[model samples]
Target: MNKNKNQYINREISWLSFNERVLQETADVNVPLIERMRFLGIFSNNLDEFFKVRYATVKRIVDAGKTGKSVLGGEKAKDILEEITTIVIKQQSKSLEILGAIEKELETENIFIIDENEVTDTQAVFLKSYFMQKVSPGLLTIILNDLREFPLLKDTAAYLAVKMVLINEVDGNENKENKYALIEIPKDIDRFVVLPNEGDKNYIILLDDLIRYSLRHIFTMFTFESISAHMIKITRDAELDMDNDLSKSFIEKISSSVEHRKISDPVRFVYDKNIADDTLSFLMDKMGIEETDSKIPGGKYHNRRDYMKFPSLGRKDLMYSKIDPLPVKDFSFEGSILEQIAQKDYLQYTPYHSFSYITKFLREAALDPQVRTIKLTVYRLASNSQVASSLINAAKNGKQVTVQIELQARFDEQANIEYAEQMQAEGVKLIFGVPGLKVHSKICVIEREENDKIKRYGFISTGNFNESTAKIYTDYTLFTAYSPLLKELNKVFDFFETTYKINKYKHLVVSPHYTKNVFIGLIDQEIKNAREGKDAFIKIKMNSFTSYKMVDKLYEASNAGVKIQLIVRGICCLVPGVKGMSENIEAISVVDKFLEHTRVFIFGNNGNSKVYISSADWMTRNLDFRVEVGCPIYDEDIKQELVDTFEISWNDNVKARMFSEQQDNAYRKNDKPKLRSQFAVYEYYQKKLNA
Candidate 1:
């Protein structure tokens, strides 16, 4: 129990710790071989984003000559940046070792990941043809030495820095000259090139090595003594810089900013460790990368994120068994989904339950003649979104469709903008949210005319409405016909249009106005109950908890003897289990097959517990800057179900890692029987369906 004077951990450091937990999955033997590789990919992908956003923010602070202690959790910005770089270098080194181990284990399963030099003559014949046909046309090779201006490297794309020692015959005098070139890895082509199978064994080579082997063909015009290529990538600042131009629309501004991100300041520069020093220095100098920038030395591969799409190779035995998304216990798609909701509120826990219910609800509203209006919020959508199509369908019908599509949903901004344009063109009224606030709440309300009375039905969720993410992100979506709650939900959309008028919510907790106050009031009640010895406890599950004010209030409650349990998946700043500070609070994080994205809060109010599912984490932006919504579970059955699920997650002994003052991600173990919460949760739903 190492204790520090600081009450909260630095949010950036805590995020790195969370990613370390993801990296741990790559080394866990219980994880399937291919899945372990994919976990490595996930770790790498998470790091790339961290540098692009979080690391870049600290860099800006340092550049601005500000200490940034208040905003950065009592640490100076420069010191935090140095600590981050040190941690990332070590994590990158460990990930390479884990990758090597996974590759060895993959060999045991009759799968081989070989390099270019290891390619057989038979494979070489196939590789040459493959490169000439599929890889040659898309390749963009730039000769750097002769160009007056350096090319602008795309932040998302990795490149092969090629160094060739050429024999330049000037007037019959053979002079040795160094020629440098960069070959952009084609994003259109697959990174993993599967060779023809030899008997029962499978073989795959990365696209980088394939291009390495065919370099002579690409530069036939140059007479070179030797040639070599190594991977290099740059991650630029991804913060969208919006220009103040009243002439342009919001979508146009976002589109321009996204385009500008291609050449923004580089926050990170990653190169293969095997690359020559001169080549590394040359690329850095040409790209104007400073020594102060985060330069990470990686393995032969740069974008291991491509491993996330590593070919399945039709090997089911080497992968975890996929489970069929279950149906909600008593809810059915056979009849109208809206009608079923009118009876009692039901919860749809996705990745365990089918996401089809959401689509079905929208589809029904589109076709139902009695429905007069459909209103929803869009954050991120799938490539071909059935949700957007259903909204368009509703508009095509007589129903008035209103969608508050957020154009600033980070990395998915372009996709959201496209959907907004298409929806707007199709007669769906579009609201781009409030000027400063991002509409992150996942709520939809519909008005239906039943016997001359307009009845409201809607759902509030703790995750995005994207179909693709719903399959992997564990979220809670509550379907209800409760008029009071739905009416408040409508007020959220109303606030989007009329920004000056602040609306009051009795049934729903809306952010940017009342989320922090409401939550603090709940914590205060728990503290009072603890003082009176009335079974006081608070259980919260969220993706992140970084608000220092909320953290201090929880610490105050902990001192008052209120038992608090937190299951935060990432970026938790509060230090739990500290004597005289937070001895009564215990926190754990779960990183497993599915992402823990649901935000649930349960307060024991003297036998009458209060429960809520929200889109907001306990972060500053969520509490003060964004428009988020938290909905109460009024139905007894559904409230009990939420409690049951949270208990199961809290009881997880396998995947759960305790949060401590030391910041070590040690797994929670005990004498109790092993319960992997993810697996147990699916089983729990199965039992409910059977019972």
Candidate 2:
């Protein structure tokens, strides 16, 4: 360990622990059965990305032969990797047990998930016909015995490793045992094949099982004694490597990098635990997998992420009841969202409030002839995004549309690139982003010719401008006509265009330069308040908090008797409640139905509360490398709303987990009203709308 680091947990390990909190949802009896299965899927999906980004980075350090202890929270990269593997194996085992329990519970509900062997005669006939029609043409099989080299397995796609004992007759020789083959699962087809519903009972088969059932039909050319297939998946390092070739455009560089990602170094190789020993050995040898690489022996299925898209089968009884998004009480869609914002700032808390306001705002901007220019920064957008369409509409209507679409937003890179090209073709001035910094700020500003002069109406959001995610991700968006703030937002758009110039911002805390210093200053104020015996408290809610500098600053404040509270949904490195270092600090994570994606910060400035909603977590990458925006809530009502919402999440007993040295992900329970904040928050908004 370096520098005697005691107060901060490793971010990677902390993240794994946070995912355990998600796994906890899978085992929570209070959760609906189908939802629990979906929770497992979420857990799996989260882990896949963690390995691709975090684990791959650590492995890079190990490959570079650096101890990397300083950056990796006082642990060697290799040590952290080993620890991660051990924890993952344990978690994976636990998840399997939870999955089994879910299946049994599902069986009670008359939902049967049948395997190939368990298929009924009538069901087998239907599956055969379905396979011949739907799955046959799409299937790509490679006979491995005669191939010169092993094919490069896809990054996250599942495959079947087959073994056959072929009858070899060479010079009257009887049999030659082992022949291997690989089958790449088609990405276009759905993973779950739902059979015809039998009265009230539901029968579904996995895609892999369907393939297994049709193995003979797939390989009619080869004569074999027996053949078997077990799912195998390779997870490649998804880090993009951009070449410094000046001849290539940014889009070309990104496109090439995305193509290169298909055959990157394999970070993980998961296979069925029951796979034949010879088959596993042969495949491992061909792939050159080593002990350093993660080789997890898994269940029958490898990509359990498909569970996320599980068929609902009209079983509303097995799912959480849907709540209609309420209208923001004072803000009406009958009038322009812009017109209302001009009067007073209104906050839109998503999933609780309809996301249509954002679209309506954009649509209004697109159609309003007076609107001359529209500018925005996008990080992640939805498939078939109306946000992009609105911008395209603005461009088509002769409006000067400028957009900073981030092409490096991880898995969404391809989608963003396609959108960028489409928008560019439509004459929207597309900005790939700042040269080195990804523009992660979720903001949009439009200038309208009101009364023969320019007036701006815009919104700053804690989440993406994407409408699809807005329905599931808990976030905060402030709709305002504040000229000064809009001017600063205009500066952000300018920063994207002019990289050499660093713009100063007074209201919005911009990152890659300002957010860290500004936040530290905020903590320093709290510390000074505590020293002077004035009321001092700092509260925050974010997805993750792993910046050691931020942690040390909070520790310094906590030691000075400043009260600090954190409602982190994932990866909290600051170990709260330490005797001297952080006794005044407390942290809890709330994992529920809706993802807690909002970033809110509050400071008790001598009885008056200062609040902000941000796009950035306290992670190092977000603070030091990305262009994130943290907007202060100047409106007192919205400030109180944020404070109230934070309190609700902080008081959660049903789904909140405490953060401590143990890292056990223990649920925070109390003898109060069972406040499930995700549900409570919806009701809170509903009542506000009613009142």
* lDDT to native, each model: 0.94, 0.91
The positional error of residue 229 in candidate 2, measured at the CA in angstroms, is 1.0
- Measured by TM-score, how close is model 2 to the native structure? 0.98
Every model's TM-score: 0.99, 0.98
| Model 1 per-residue lDDT tens digits across residues 481-535 | 9999998988898999999999999989999999999999999999999999889
Candidate 2 residue pairs in backbone clash: none
Top candidate by lDDT: 1
Residue-wise lDDT of candidate 2 within 505-585, one digit each (tens)? 989999999999999999999999999999999999999999999999998998888999999999999998888788899
Model 1 segments beyond 4 Å from truth? 1-4
